[model samples]
Target: MLKKIGFVGLGTVGKHMAENLAKSDYALTVWDEDAEAAAALGKLGVKVGSSAKETAKGQDLVIVIVPESEQIVFGAEGVLEGIDPGTIFVDMGTHCPETIERMSKEAVKRRAMFLEAPVWGSKEHAANGLLTILAGGDEALLGRCREPFSYFGLNIIHIGKVGDATRMKMIVNMLQAELLVSLSEGLVMGNKMGFTPDKILEVLDSGGVASPLFHSKGRSIARGDFSRNLALKYVHSQLERVLEAAQKFGLELPAAETARKLYAQADADGRGEEDFSAIIKLLRR
Candidate 1:
């Protein structure tokens, strides 16, 4: 029954998700720091808000997706400033569970509902509406957002209460980062053994280790196309968050720690802006 939507953040993934949402029956208002990003959505008949506050005003739901954890959501001019009581605020960006917990408190103070529904998958999955949504909060609240979510999510999983979705997202990102690093090492060893990257991919595709992730990333990495589907810097940051959480729980993740160092080296080498799979370039060296 939530028909009006306020969407903030129109970066690489957000823009496409908003574009898809615009196709639905909901009345959509969008805002972003980037005027050009907002303009593109405006051209699609989606109302463009002059500010985050304006976008959030008079909406059934205010959705935020951005890099920063606190400022972009609860800052002076952020969505919290314009959200009406009873309006739901859903954060779809990946962030640490601690940050999300702080945000939940602020939403409670304002008498507004908060739900953390960080997504899994990357830019292409977002564009195609195949992204999986890991939702955390009241199940009834999640059910209300389900229709709008369907506009951009192929899978919607209810993941416990307010902070659980972010924790799950970090866990998923950790595995994704580790697997990509593992693949990078495999491709590197194959190259050193005088096999082509494509040939290595062919053999991997035929084996027990085969996966859609390996197939997609391996082919793009083979073609030397490191265009950004998921930025390496974000992946590195996620791994860092995962390790930090692991330490808090008195756990050790040897593979993730090593993968973070490799990703860190690539980030330091100025490959942070490239696709996450570009870490293979570091292994090649």
Candidate 2:
């Protein structure tokens, strides 16, 4: 029953999520550093707030989806400054678990609730309201926010308490990075061995290893079209975080480490803003 919503961050995926929320019965107010992005949402009946703090005031719920944790949680005009007591704040960005835990503690001190609810899937999924939400924090707070989540999330999994969702997301991204690298390597090997990319895709699709990710990204890879479904730089950042988390537990992820290098290479080559699938370019070279 959390009706009044304050939404921050209007990036590639965040804008679509805010648009979905606007379609719901809730009253929505949004703020972003990009005036054009905020103005675009204004046409859809979403009120534009001058700052993050201004957006949080009077809101029953505040949702943040920025690229970094500090952008929404820290600063003079941050969400924390304007959030009223009893307001539930959901951060749906992939960030450091330790950072999320620290922010959660701060929210509690202010009598506000904070939930880490990072999502799975790309911009396309956000646009279609089919993203999978991995939630952490109190179950009761999650229950109260379920209605708004339904607008943009097809599946909502409550992983555990605060910080757990971020840990899970890092693990998920670790596997995802490995898979993309494997796909690229396989395609490169196939091309070098006189096999067509389409043939390789067809064979993979006919096997148990086939997945929605492979099918969608595979087609894009075959056509040499890596047009930014998910940015390569962000995927690289996630891989770095995953490795950091693994190192903290005295474990090493060799495959993820390898994939991370390839992504890093892609970013260094000025393809950072391209689709993560663009890592295939490294293999192609």
Candidate 3:
């Protein structure tokens, strides 16, 4: 059991994940780009560190959740540069799969264990300790980390080697974007056809198409509450990556592309910080 754990990145998801780990009695040493974010976690009894190296020093495990792959490995005081030789470093951010592989190889060369462990679900799910985790690394290592992951995740799956979890996370997020796009179009089209969103949701709830994703955000849409939960800017970036990868494989994804365009439009309209369901505003207009 890795006892002293260090965390880098304190975004919406990372904050809650660290809080869960802290609540589980892990001796947490943490750092974040935002000093106030670190202070907030420090108030929770976590040791707030000034830099990633300080966070990593002597910790059995180091976890990173930065926005990009490069930062995960080579940012100012990144996890790779700071983690101890024998410590396990888990990359939980959604990032490029190739980057995951390259970083893992480099970490191994430095005698550190590296694992890709991207999570699925929003900040709410993270706060509730219900996110689903997809992990890729040595199977034995993944098994060793499962108990801690279980404290904050509903399920944890060991997919394959180093880059596999990033790929899996992309696929998962792409499907989520697709569903959001389709549901947004359906709701707007229903409203245009003289049916209230509530009526359409009533039908959807009774139909085979109903799901928690739809029920949760659909209710938000029906209630006209489009505040940020998952931002459109993040979704747009992930869709761009998905498209680039799909193009490399010679696949045409019209629906995904359409969804990508809607996100881009929403970004242009300054709704990038708004929930993904806010894409309906463009359609409804």
The candidate maximizing lDDT is 2
1 or 3, greater by TM-score: 1
Model 1: worst 10 consecutive residues (lDDT sum): 68-77
Candidate 2 has a TM-score of: 0.97
lDDT of 2 at 116: 93
The list of candidate 1 runs beyond 4 A from truth reads: none
TM-score of 3: 0.96
Give the clashing residue pairs of candidate 1, or none: none
lDDT of each: 0.90, 0.91, 0.86
Per-residue lDDT tens digits of candidate 2, residues 91-182? 99998877798779878888998999999998899999999999999998899988999999999999999989999999889888889988
lDDT by residue for model 1 (32-124), tens:
999999999999999999889889888899999988645567777788888888899998988887778877887888888999999888788
lDDT of 3 at 36: 95
For all candidates, what are the clash counts?
0, 0, 0
lDDT of 3 by residue, 225-252 (tens): 9877778888899999999999999999
Instruction: Return whichever of 2 and 3 wins on TM-score.
Output: 2
**How many clashes does the backbone of model 3 have?**
0
